[model samples]
Target: MNTMKKLAAISLVTAALAAPADLTASARPARATGLPAAAKGCVPAMIDNFMTGAYRSPDLTTGSVTNTESGAMLGGRRTTRFQVAGNPFGFPSTAVVAPGDKSLLAVSSGYKGPTALAVFYGLRSEAHPEVLRADLSCFKRFEVNFVANDLPLNINVEVKSASSPTVYQCGVNTEAGQTNGFRLEFPFDCFVTNDPAHPPVDWTRIDRVLLLIQSASAMAANDYAINFFRLAS
Candidate 1:
């Protein structure tokens, strides 16, 4: 799991879902002070260091976030491949740029455990499992930096491993109208494992990262927005 940081820090969360229900959205790899010490041969695999904005973008778009990049990654714009339950999935999930000119990524998800996900297809080759894990080894933790408003009053972030089909999820306690930058950390241990044959997380081929929001407390407020994001440490 990743270390959730607000203001690039955390204030001892109350566990479980908390506070009021407000998706009036707004929007952590490490406490990366500045860049990195040097470009490691691969994505920094430093367990002690949170690598942010230091990895190769490969084909990174100009935008700060990748909510819109999922379509291209999965070779489709709207998809039902990520849903675990709640059949009769709704129409296309949306990724909208909020006010302040590309300020936030506003993602509108459907009811019934709405999930928004994007895959970085082939970012790491399955041909080299050893190489893949070695490259991403430093990243034992995962967290996102964002401002929470109206979206997933009770939030869970899921990551699908390449080795298994189970979607591992960790609950995040989101604070409303929080432009102060809240982060939910999901470490490897936090992911639930139903497959005994393969590990819950296949670091070598991490596949896709999905944002599964709890059914919106208020349907109208299910959609949410965030300032930006960071994947590091």
Candidate 2:
């Protein structure tokens, strides 16, 4: 899709959900630099590294990860989903972590419309009575290390709070010409809703977080992989 159409699709998706209540129109897109001076060289809080190579089905359509690594934000669960219901091009042909590979690799086969390989964070484990949440108030941005094969990918975040079950989303796209893979930073402020009546996203009570992929063109298969995802200061 061209720039105008791509942006229009983004706006339609967010408007269908609801608008943000507390955010200003001054929000910006993802940036490579500009971290606060105090946060320079600060260690990131790990969200997932996809090191376990775990998947629920043989086709790899669904899978779960229980992060045991140190510095991970939540110890509960994270899973992948490739929703195929309204998609005419069929589900992703490949979505798995190969035996020796540490990254979660996903390959789409000419899928159309808005579909994402979603990673859900802070899932309630069997031992927990309630949904687990990660307090990310201290983090100012999200750092994602990934490679895309010239696919116009949009990285979206969905969060929920105690007062509302409604899911609010905000996202940024990978910069053009970064097909070789790059580490991009998405600041928290970039995630905003369109409806002012909707409750603002509460970073302190974050019940769930999702990293999604949206491609503008679907004429061919899309290759994407992630090495690490984190919340940083």
TM-score of each: 0.46, 0.63
Local distance difference test, each candidate: 0.36, 0.50
Instruction: Please write out the lDDT profile of model 2 over residues 67-186, one tens digit for every residue.
Output: 211213343345455533244545434456432454554544344534445565543322221243445777888877876555666666666554454556666655444567787777
For candidate 2, the per-residue lDDT at 58 reads 32
Off by over 4 Å in 2: 1-44, 56-73, 85-92, 99-101, 108-115, 124-130, 175-177, 218-220
Instruction: Please give the distance, in angstroms, between residue 48's alpha carbon in candidate 2 and its true position after superposition.
Output: 0.3
Query: Candidate 1: minimum summed lDDT over ten consecutive residues — where?
Result: 19-28
Residue 120 of candidate 1: its Cα lDDT? 24
Clashes of 2: 6
List candidate 1 segments past 4 Å from native: 1-94, 98-102, 108-135, 195-198, 218-220
